[model samples]
Target: MMKKWLIVIVFSLVALFLAACSDDGDKASGGKSDGDTVNLDFWVFGSTGYQELVDEYMEENPNVKITINEGEMNDMHNNLFTSISAGSGAPDIAQIEVSQVEKFLQAKDQFHNLNDYGAEDVAENFLDWKWAQAQTVDGEFQIGLPTDIGPTTMFYRIDVIEAAGLPTDREELAAEIDTWEAYYEAAKKVKEETGKYMTDTPQLVYNAIRDQQDLQYFNEDDELIMEDTVKEAYDFTTKMIEEDLIGQNELWTPEWGTAMAEGTYATMPGAPGWMVANVKGNAPDASGNWDIASIPEGAGNWGGSFLTVPKESEYPQEAYDFISWLTAPEQQLRSFEIAGLFPSTPDVYENEEFLATTDEYFNGAPTAQIFAEAAKSVKTVYMGVNYAIVDTEISTALVNVAVDGADPQAEWDAAIERITSQLERQ
Candidate 1:
């Protein structure tokens, strides 16, 4: 009877230990057991070429599943804000545009600090500037991983420029219009000779020039500082509008597509690598007639995005692991090949495959090499939380001057006043 009781006690103890181990395993996997599936919801705006990657990831890790929600950039951002305010309904992971990231940083508690899941170990994988952009001002918290970068360059129509009696070779044209002043002079010649506007809009010219500055609307300390470059860009754009050297077509409009197809504009400066897709998609008939050159004198970044794990995520570790893998150098290069979204990983910039990339749409221009050099030249600038707000006001003022015939100085003054008032309210 004693031996039988000992055996039974041993069996009971073993069962309890096994049950405890199973519970611990489930907790570690965010309440899912090893054999159970882990599902993640991902939100993003625009085509990031992530669906293919997500499919691959699921195949490799059959225990995990991911669903992606694609929406327009503005609508998705607004929806995210609403979800965050509701304290529920947020996706496990979200993609935030570079300009808008600063705004989200203001509500940092809503995001998981990626450093908690070994993000610091992969910091060297991305460009220094891009990596810094997602971190807190004190560098204590990181909200996301860099996905893509926008390095500006001059995308021009080969035949339109040649028709203006200008050099068509990339190097020759780059040298001829090496300065903004020189660029404006060439614009005049293009208008006078070819009767085509130099660019689609004066606002684009202002954007390119304004972004090139080492300082923008705000400093690292979050102080509003409008540098001389901003005024210069404003004046330059207004001068183009006055001279009738720019087209009235707003970007993304049907008229803008017509203008590009008909060669109404000769060139678009400060265009990012991703613009290659827009040009190809909008003006398929004009293939081989277009080419890319370096932006005048220097380069600037225009657009990019980061992937973040929201604090509401039940599986933060899984979300981090997936994003880290998705944004790795290899995947980023693949994204470039698939979507023309330039990689933020500098290591990918030197990859032989990346270096050899050329576009038949741009007359086989060494598109990759040109953009890589431009990306290297871009300076690190701090975009404050109010950067986008300030930029919108300034852009609105520019339109008032260019379209409504508002006085340049009066509009500038009013914009400054409005930006100050808005910032104070926020």
Candidate 2:
């Protein structure tokens, strides 16, 4: 990014020199006049397909030129954090993942509050939970505009379920596993008929149930709610593990791919679109064997992102203009069309094209509508600044019990202690 900026500066200087060297009338000689170009430095992370979008935006607005630097999500976030702390070298705008967004809330003042630029007026355009995630209590000091949302839906292996003598129909299977209890019973039947497990691992099931709850680890006031909701979620996860319904494989690993390809699991409880894509990508040989369904209980989200303008940006208004346009309903729809990033905008849900789209990977299933309905139905969760850390602590507790034969009660007590200790330090 620095090198690109230096080159732009040199090019501007050469343009000034050429103008000055030209023989003109008594009019103002060639020296660079006031620069009108809004050169914005944008850092995008992950497979957002923003490069093409930025090219389109630049072509439409010749006066504005944006330089996009892309990298992995973790790298981009680390760089942004360093720059923010150093008070220099930050990009005009950057992408932040939902899980990591809470970390920035502690330094909220470092961002250009989108609310100051009239972002609240279009709040209805986005899904309520996504919009709420980036704002303060009064909707003041909103630091980001919602982009792609990850609404949870079930993905299952049709062949595996059929092999277990379960209904192969999507709606019928949906009814069969409409609740966690039903899902476990179905798992038992599947295991009895065939040696395959019901799902990948206990942690995912734990997370799926935890995400759906109104309060998982913390309340809106940042009070810990472990004893009430978290304990129950853990207990359910432990029961599944104890019953041997879950396979002992890590997500997104070679073992996971092999399991999918071999039809070792009958169902995935609820997953984001990208995670479902991950499943499909890893097991392409199993094409036409997998499909999506409604989440057993209801909707929950596991992934998404925000586009934020930093306070250090010299072109704040122009940057905001670019992000607002990028995250707007029309552009979000384009993104989904290009990259499978489910739109956060509810208005796009009514688009006939989106509703009618089907996936061959799921045997021409109407996954588009499935995801859109789940997107709107998601409950709003007010995660505190300590969410990532606290959630990880609890997740580790589940892992300990599953892998080490640790007592569930003991693990739960340890998780609470870790969360309280870590959050207090934060």
Candidate 3:
């Protein structure tokens, strides 16, 4: 009877130990279990060519499999918000746009700090300001790695530029029209000689000028700085309108496409990501005539994205490794090839392979050099939570003043009032 009781107690203890081990295994690490075939779920939006990179990663590491979930930007952002709120159902890694980064940063605990994995050590690989966009308010947390940047450049019709009696050579043009005043003078000549507008709308001109300033619409504390810098940008754009230097077409409209194809305008201020596709889609007929140049005065970033590892990932280290590799200098070059996803990494800027390549659309101009120079010079601007909303409102005010004959000062006042009320309501 003593032997039988001892056996029962020993077996009971063994059973409890086994149950505890099973529970520990259920808690996955970083998105994978140790010594098991690891599967990671990645969320990416648009054709960033990240999915292709993932396939390459998996091919090399057969034990690690990744599933990609692609969604429209808005939908992806909404899903992220939902997942973060629920504290579950998030992907191992996700791509977040610059416009949406601040939105997510509010829920800082929801993401793994990339700084923890030594992201700053690789900071030299990317443009300074572009890399700065991924940090938290205090810069204590690095949440993401920059994927691509939209450094605004002037995409022009070489023929139209030459016909206007302005220098068509990229170097000469950059030197001669290095200032907004010089650019405006050239625009007047283009209108006089070719009767084609210098730009499609005042908003683009506003963007070119606005991006030059160290600040846009708002200061560091989310305060309005309209009377000085903002007003100057607004007035300059209005001057173009009052002087008849722009075509009256709104952006992304059928008329805008028709104007572009027909050479109704001489230049398009393009953000790299949108420009490459826009030219291919809307102005295909002007293939060899198009070329790119640095924006007058200075360069400003218009769009870009970052890749992040969410806190919900069971495998945070693995997630970081994947993003770091995806955005590594070599992979960035590959992405630039697959899509016009411009490299955020400056390491590739001086690479012969990158500089040697020329696009047939830009008349075989060495565009990589022009873009690289612009990307290098971009000023570090702090984007507040109201960046997007304020940008839209100001664009509307530009149209009103430039197109609808609204008085510039009154329009400026109206914009301020509207934005103030909007912020107050929020």
Candidate 3 per-residue lDDT over residues 354-391, each given as its tens digit: 99878888888776777887888888877776677777
**2 versus 3: better lDDT goes to:** 2
Model 1's TM-score against the true structure: 0.93
Residue-level lDDT tens digits of model 2 in 1-426: 999999999999999888766523212221122455778899988788888899999998787889999998888998999998889999989888888787787788888888877788888888888998888777767888999988888888998899899988888888888998988899998899888889977777888888898887777787777887777878988888888888877666688778878888898876888775687778878879998888889989988999998888876777888899999889998998888899999999899998998999897888879899888889988887778888888878887877787888898889888888887887
Itemize residue pairs with steric clashes in candidate 1: none
lDDT of 1 by residue, 283-388 (tens): 9899899999999979999999999988888788888889999999999988888777899999987898789988888999999899989988898888989898
Q: How high is each candidate's TM-score?
A: 0.93, 0.90, 0.92
The model with the greatest lDDT is 1
Q: In model 1, state the lDDT of residue 396.
A: 86
**Model 2 ranges with Cα > 4 A deviation:** 1-35
Clashing pairs in 2: 19-30
Global Cα lDDT for candidate 3: 0.82
Against the reference, the lDDT scores of all candidates come to: 0.89, 0.84, 0.82
